[model samples]
Target: MKIHDIPGFPNPLRVRVVLAAKGLLDKVDFVPVDLPGAEHKRPPFLAINPTGTVPVLELDDGTYISECTAITEYLDNLDGNPILTGKTALEKAMVHMMQKRAESELIDAIGIYFHHATPGLGEALQPYKHPEWEGRTYWGEMHREKALAGMHYFDSVLRKQPYIAGDFFSMADATVLGGLLFAFYAQIPVPSALTALLEWKERVDQLPAVIQASA
Candidate 1:
């Protein structure tokens, strides 16, 4: 399989973490896409993923899979043991629920703040963004506020449990880790009172899979 992604990007980093966790990093080829150059928006790359997004998985059979969560699902299930995602029905539902929350509340929120409020990747990608509205900065600020709320929410959850969904490390944790990565880049500060969430980040940073993925 060929993984097309731009290094250091949040979504692509999410996929890389999944691959590392599943011990499948060595099995796939990493194809770097030039994001700064807007190569992903061009024809040759758009053919692989019409969305023009990075971190697309191209299967050996010539199937292209986009979306970080979907790609993680495929990798987590490939070995049949299902570690990152859950195995049982209840576990599956819970994990999926938390994963989606992580994406929407934290990851996507920070992403919007980065793209809309900030300069984003570059002027090259600006045309692809939404038509600039009069209140665009206000909208981006709202998203930043949402991301902060998400941080507090997760911190509250972590105070009662070790992981996002429960006791075990799961894909939800991976999504939060990716969110935190983006938050750091976007200069969104985590609440100083959220000790649990800050400690959780420290623990996740020490994970072998996360280390491998970052490497």
Candidate 2:
């Protein structure tokens, strides 16, 4: 398998962390995609994923998978001993539920703010993501506030449990980690008052898989 992405990117980091957690990081080849150059928005890359997104997974037989959640599902289930996703019926539901919340309320929200409110990836990607729209900037700012509220919500959730979904570290935790990383790049600082969230992040940062992905 091969992953097409730019290194150190937020979404790519999410998948890379999944690969590390599944012990399959070394088994896959990583192809760099020039995100800042708008390479993904071109026809060649669009053929693989019409959404024109990065961190696309190419299977050996020539299947292309996009979206961090979908890619994670395939990788996690490959060995039959799924870890990042869930093992049981109820676990899967909870994991997916929280994962969706993580994406919508935090990561994706920050993405809108980052790409619209600010000069996101510079001039090359501007046509695809219009940075000049006054209305869009206002919309993006609204999402930034949504992201802030998301932080508090997650902090409350973490205060009551060990992980984002419950007792075990599941896909939701990984999504939260990725979301926090995105928040950093978006310049959306996590307030120090969210102790539960900060503490959970500290614990996750110490995981071997997270350390490996960071390296």
Candidate 3:
């Protein structure tokens, strides 16, 4: 199989972490797409994925898979261990639900906040180069506040459970981990009430899978 992705980008990073956790990194060839140059927007690349998003997985049979969460689910089910996603129907439902919650409430909100507000890496991320989004104080401020509020909500959720879905570490944890890192990279300060969130991040960071994928 072949995987195309960008390093450090929150969504793509989620797929990489899943590959590492599933021990499929060595088995798959990881191709790094040039995001800054808008390579993904070009024809040859668009032929593979119309969305032109990072973390596109191509199976040996010529099937392509996009979307970070879907890729993680595909990888998890490839083997019998079934740890990253879930084994039973109920577990799968809960895992998918929690993953959706994190993506909707935290990841997507934070992305809107960052892209429309602070140009962190600036030109290195080409989409933010448009002047239309620059200096729009009102919307930027609103999205930033929404992103911060989402983090606060996640902090409360983490305080009650060992993992986002409840107990076992599932795909939801991976999604949340990448989102928090994005928040950190974007210079959003994690609130003090999120002690559990911080602790969970530390634990996930220590995993061999995380270190390898991040490297």
Q: Please provide TM-scores, in order, for all candidate models, with all chains considered together.
A: 0.97, 0.98, 0.90
- Sort the predicted structures by lDDT, highest score first: 2, 1, 3
Give the range where candidate 1 is weakest over 10 consecutive residues by summed lDDT.
128-137
Checking candidate 1 for backbone clashes, the offending pairs are none
lDDT tens digits, residues 82-133, model 2? 8888899989999999999999999999999998888888989999886557
Judging by TM-score, tell me the better candidate of 2 and 3. 2
lDDT of 2: 0.93
Best by TM-score: 2
RMSD of 3: 2.2
Question: Model 1 Cα displacement at 168 (Å)?
Answer: 1.2
Residues 1-215 of candidate 1: C-alpha lDDT, one tens digit per residue: 99999878788888898999899989999999999788999999999899998889999999999988899899999978899889899889989999999999999999889888888888888877674676777888899999999999999999999999888889899999989999999999898999999999999889999899999
* Superposed model 1: Cα runs more than 4 Å off: none
The positional error of residue 186 in candidate 1, measured at the CA in angstroms, is 0.8
Candidate 3 is scored at a TM of 0.90
In candidate 2, which residue ranges exceed 4 Å CA deviation?
Answer: none
Looking at candidate 3, the ten consecutive residues that score lowest on lDDT are: 125-134
What is the lDDT for 85 in model 2? 84
Q: Compute the lDDT of residue 98 as modeled in candidate 1.
A: 94
